[model samples]
Target: MNESAFQAGAARVDITPPLGTLINGDFITHYARFIHDPLYAKALVLQQGKTTLALVIVDICAMPKDLLDEVKIALQNETGLLPQQVLIASTHTHAAGSVASLLLGAADLPYRQKLPALLIESVKAALQHRRPAKIGFGAVDVPEHVVCRRFFMKEGYQALNPVTGGLDGVKTNPFGDEQQIDRRVAPVDPQVSFLAVKGLDDQWISVLANYSLHYVGDWENGTITADYFGVFSEEIGRLLQAGPGFVGMMSNGTSGEANIWDFLDPDRYPKAHFAKSELIGKDIAGKVANALQAIGWQEAPELSARYTEVAAGVRKPSAEELDAAKKLAAESQYETIQQVDRDALRRIYAREQVLLNDYPDTNLFPVQALQIGTGRIGALGAEFFAETGLKLKQNHQPYFTITMANGYIGYVPPAHEIERGGYETWRCRTSFLEPGAEEAIRTQLVELLKAEAERPVYSSYEIKQYER
Candidate 1:
């Protein structure tokens, strides 16, 4: 292994939990009884001129910052890769085993305990199989698959805010009701960006794709599947005719306010168990496979990573709100999160208020940037809006965002969206972040990316122009 030679390796380890493990990503808890498809922790490692970077993509809904921090430390001690050099992200699949408590879904203790060792194994295996390789970046617009989940309803329709008991201007997931929707609130990022890695002999080593459609959650609760994320990975590998050693990873992009549902065209989008997910995944894979033919491969491009933490205030409940929530909880007599009525939004959100009141006044959220060849991968610890991601790309081309990476700080809706007061801005445990959190995260991340790519820092005026 020559120190100057660019090399890469890829590996995956099964992370599918046993039946009866809790599956999360919903307002209520679901236990996995049947495994629709196996979940995995996939790792891709790249090295050039003594610089090494490892990216790990897991097929889970989300992992807590503390859990991933501990995993990074173990990886550091074992593989000597610093925490900054290791970029770990969740695919944001709603049907996988729960590792982080969200809404009413508590962490599956048995399944959570197995993740650390398995994640470590995936990376170590990739390290052991490094081979001389080349890399290229490719992107294709696939707009038809992603749609804005949030919408501005018709003027007469009342969009109620569950937390504040007021009318919101915007509504989320207003499924199958186009008559009430005035228009979509946002635009979907159509770009399906990917990084293709191959051995010097042109055999595929790995392909990592990023898209802004959060997840295609067509599966029923209690089914353990990776939604479309796993489908895309497998489909891409098969499309490329890659060997068994080849790996394919699809990371979640800025999709806090987007999904795969088209409400206006209701008849066109009917929910089948896994039919829609498989179709969307393979279609996106086909797009990537076709685009790969034109990529200009780079045998040795620079690899660098930058990581920082920015403090953001938690959207804690006011004293009056907390008092009201306490009264509601006492009246409901719910002993546990699961015991709370899933259909009762007021009761469910009251529990969230009580829990969020205990959160620290401020939290240090992680922001990271990784540069490989001419592509820059930005990582944030929250489910950010599509607008935030698009703003970052304005400052630099060939850039994509990885959300819920390193940790989960809940949803980082833009200040304007917060004013609209939809489900994503309803100030619950799942959406508890300050209004300005989005701007703060994006500003810091853009600076980090500029430094990593050796580009000049944007002036205040330039940033303002970009934001405009």
Candidate 2:
């Protein structure tokens, strides 16, 4: 091994605390029911010479962009790493801390202030413990456990055409109309891709697993936990030959409408479903370990990593639209919808329109591309639907992994889903990004991929060059 190759160190900090109350879109509060002991916020640090990159994955519910910005700023100031170099991703756990902005009807300021500090500490500890390591990439398909929760149905409750068939005339757009859809057309992609890094002594240091399946697991009691990602991380740690220090970070993929529990089917809801968070965690971890064994160890050097920000147009609500939303929210049967509408009404009545600026139509979407040897890891800003993810993988050849919903800009449904005018689409009271948002994202990713593919290969020097 070269004496001066890149090194990696990982550390996980338990942030599941004295219970910061949790809430989901359903507006029902729930406490953390520990299916497994202890939830965590994990950090993995990679250093190539002086260029250091730190990735922190939190098992919290959706991470607000502002909070993430704060964490990034603190990391940059503390460790001299650029904001882009310090990638912070949430597991989208509905059972974890309450950090989402209040406009979406979820706001807990006390916990939100403390979260960034906790995350920063986790990253600092990981960077402090950096050591020489080897990284390998592998993936496995495990689609059976996950399914798309949103579906299209006619007014009479008959199945509508699927959007995957090029969106010609799908009757319902799941993203646009929040109220009418009764069933989903298909399940989301459930492939779990991972990057395994181990120390020179063969101790597993960090395992970054990316999967597309929203976590709506047994979450009904306002408890602070890591949801399925935490369970998966714990399982991976137990399976690792290394000590408890083995860090596993599960980054959610394109799962805007996908979840372990089928919301439309009450049988699959949290209380009735047989697929526990622990089981989901264990299954993915085992599959990752299995893939690791078959592939063995390979030295992967950081070829190139770049970050870009695109202005994603948000759908703005007009005075009439706001009035209509307030009316619907006041009369809606769902408490969650009512709460959001009531809040919006209060703001409108108080002339507190400035608050809406924070929730504007155009959002700064961050897209990050990291090339490890020949593999690529793409991070998107929004909760992209599965079709967008699959398209990115298909167009970008040799894409080792593509993770969406990293920043969680609500949901980016396919054009057809947008036209179906369902909850995800209608809830956006901001800019109407053309139906081609998915295509635009894919195009940008392809551009990045082409650049990375043209870059020189670095692994050839680490091992005897072998052609695949």
Candidate 3:
């Protein structure tokens, strides 16, 4: 158990908006909410020998391709690291900064204009903040808090019910068969993994935590927020901090169909359960803390990295479908719908129209794999279903973490779920890819993992501070 075996650096940038404003969709006309006091972009850099890998965690809703590319290019050029070596992940915060132009409506044009500089500065700060630190990993299961949203209907009658008025005899719960309906699906990785770091004096630096549960606690109002990630970070930092300087960076795991909301069993809906998200966050953080207490430190030796983009096709709506969607969107008035049925109906029509051109029928999915000693990290570009993450971990040797929605290319539903055609699989206004996208990603990932396993071992580099 050597404390000096690894060098670590952590930096946090305040990405808070000027005045908590709504950036996603056409919400400016209706609500007036400011960003809460805290929103951040945090980074963790780990080095073993000449090979260094950097993980950037943003509190934003998601990382669109353009913005992610801009950040990646800037960080690579400045840090002298290959673009593929850096992994940028989002917290999937629905209330955070607007990055998706087509989905969220162009970020306040001014905000979009200034974002690149902010992003650059944040990454630079993280790299500059490197320090001698020790890292330890641990995991725990928090089953009661999260569940798979894709409920299979068992009764044939329920499956036959129409999801929309216009689609006659269309099955609502397409995946539900008489035998499978009502069965609860599990997370790809039900375990929460924590990587704890501390300075030479045993001072806490940051805890890099991973969990596979979707973020949907916040609403579509005009507010600058980090949703559950923000709350989770704040709670963890407060609990672990001996003083200021201590931080917590949360990386979203495979959470595609996994959500705190149990959509299948409507009885579990937390309408009055405001504390549910907080409880889930705090419970996981506590488990991470407990895990950190048990692990012994070991020097991480050797590093390898690679990045590839897999083409996942887009989903397109017909011209007539687009017109209908646009018309429905105009009527919704951005008002909150009380009835689940009405809301579901409106969302179906609205999404079909808006996503018609934006959804990817073919997607160039970015999959980056980085290795540090025996530990391996996999970067998945889309909001991956929990099942996919579980499969990767089960198949890959020495897998450390699987971060989902990294450089987000939208949701990657499981093959069977795609046929069901729900919010995640069908929301894309662009050309939707085939149902096999998840398998394709998993296959490529397995190849990367195998390659990493065969690579030769290396050692950590000596830290030498450079004069500015």
Candidate 4:
């Protein structure tokens, strides 16, 4: 149609860790005892005229900047794509292998060592397989699947801060005592935004979807799975009657404060392990399949990307606090922070404080925006809140966010939410970004999206009329 110049390709490489690899995301370390399902680094390469952009979604908890920066350099050396032209993100599945150290769960050094080559392989394969393609954008709202994990407790209920040994106004992931919960502290985002790509012959290529549900973690411990993200890939392919080449990727959105656990109505989900995740994955796939039928395909939609690093402060431990932490950490009977119990949170947080004391006072986190077809996707290097994602969508229509992209900078709650004091706002390496980080990240991303929208490719009279 109308002299098309777009091309696309998709490929996936197994990145599943071997048995005995340590998995992060929880307070304690859990080793991979079995392969419940294989993990992967799925890549999609897009080209329009002389410009090319790549997106890779990996099945893991999180990857720090140092690790990903090395991967980016290798990719650039082999493919000539700049760091800003590539957008790599994690699915944030707690069941996968550790690539970044969080809490007491250390990075699996051997597993991390093997990751770069696999990631590079996926991208190179996708680049070699590029074909003439058409792309479309679609979204659906499935509010029933998302629930805000943070809540305001009733009077006299203590929401303890492990770092300070004091009371917090809000609690996260509270269960059993639902009556003590006054109301949800924040709202959840349920929008499932997707980019659907197909070859000129009408053959399926890939579907890249985004949603804000943090993760569906229902599998047993010591198992390696991609959580619901991998299941969605399978279910979507089956529903669409897609061939083996079809790639279905579900990237995590601003899900720092969202999850599938409905504490107010615990019975709403299945009680069996792995069943809830399967149900959610299939249900979400069904929604995507239904929406796919209505998309308006574009044979030659423009492709562009913008990336920048925004300055954000880190909540490093103060000298006085570090001194106290040293004293408590030394007195603890546990060998590692992972061995500390619920009653010994002071010891666990002390270790986090000592670790954070080595961090810089301010760091630069990446913010990226990509324009594919009529869809706008924003990428952030941290776990952000649902409100931030919703605000971005409201400001820029047909736009969605992909979190834990490029690098990991920890959780970024809104300043107001940080003041409320939940587990996500506690002083730890996982939640060390300053309260103002959200606002700064949001402001930068919005400007980036605006710049992409104003690019010359969409400046023509015919294109302007079609955009409306």
After superposition on all C-alphas, the RMSD of every candidate to the true structure, in Å, is 5.1, 7.9, 6.5, 5.5
RMSD versus native structure for model 4: 5.5
Q: C-alpha displacement of 420 in model 4, angstroms?
A: 0.6
- Please, what are the lDDT tens digits per residue for candidate 3 over residues 260-330? 66545545544543355566677777777666677766445566776666766565666776776777777
Lowest lDDT sum, 10 consecutive residues, model 1, at 458-467
User: Local error of candidate 4 at 382, Å?
Assistant: 0.9
Where does candidate 4 stray beyond 4 Å? 1-4, 336-340, 452-468
lDDT of 3 at 447: 76
lDDT of 4 by residue, 114-233 (tens): 999999999999988789999999999989899999998899998888888888889998766688989998788889999899999999999999989999899888989998999998
Deviation in Å, model 3, residue 79 alpha carbon: 2.5
Backbone clash pairs in model 2 (N, Cα, C under 3 Å; residues 3+ apart or in different chains), count: 35
Clashes of each: 0, 35, 41, 0
Report the poorest 10 consecutive residues by lDDT, candidate 2: 459-468
User: Which tens-of-lDDT digit does each residue in 171-210 have in candidate 1?
Assistant: 8888545788889998878889889999999999999999
Model 2 CA deviation exceeding 4 Å by range = 1-3, 20-25, 28-37, 102-104, 158-183, 262-275, 326-361, 397-406, 429-434, 452-468
Superior by lDDT: candidate 1 or candidate 2: 1
Clashing pairs in 4: none
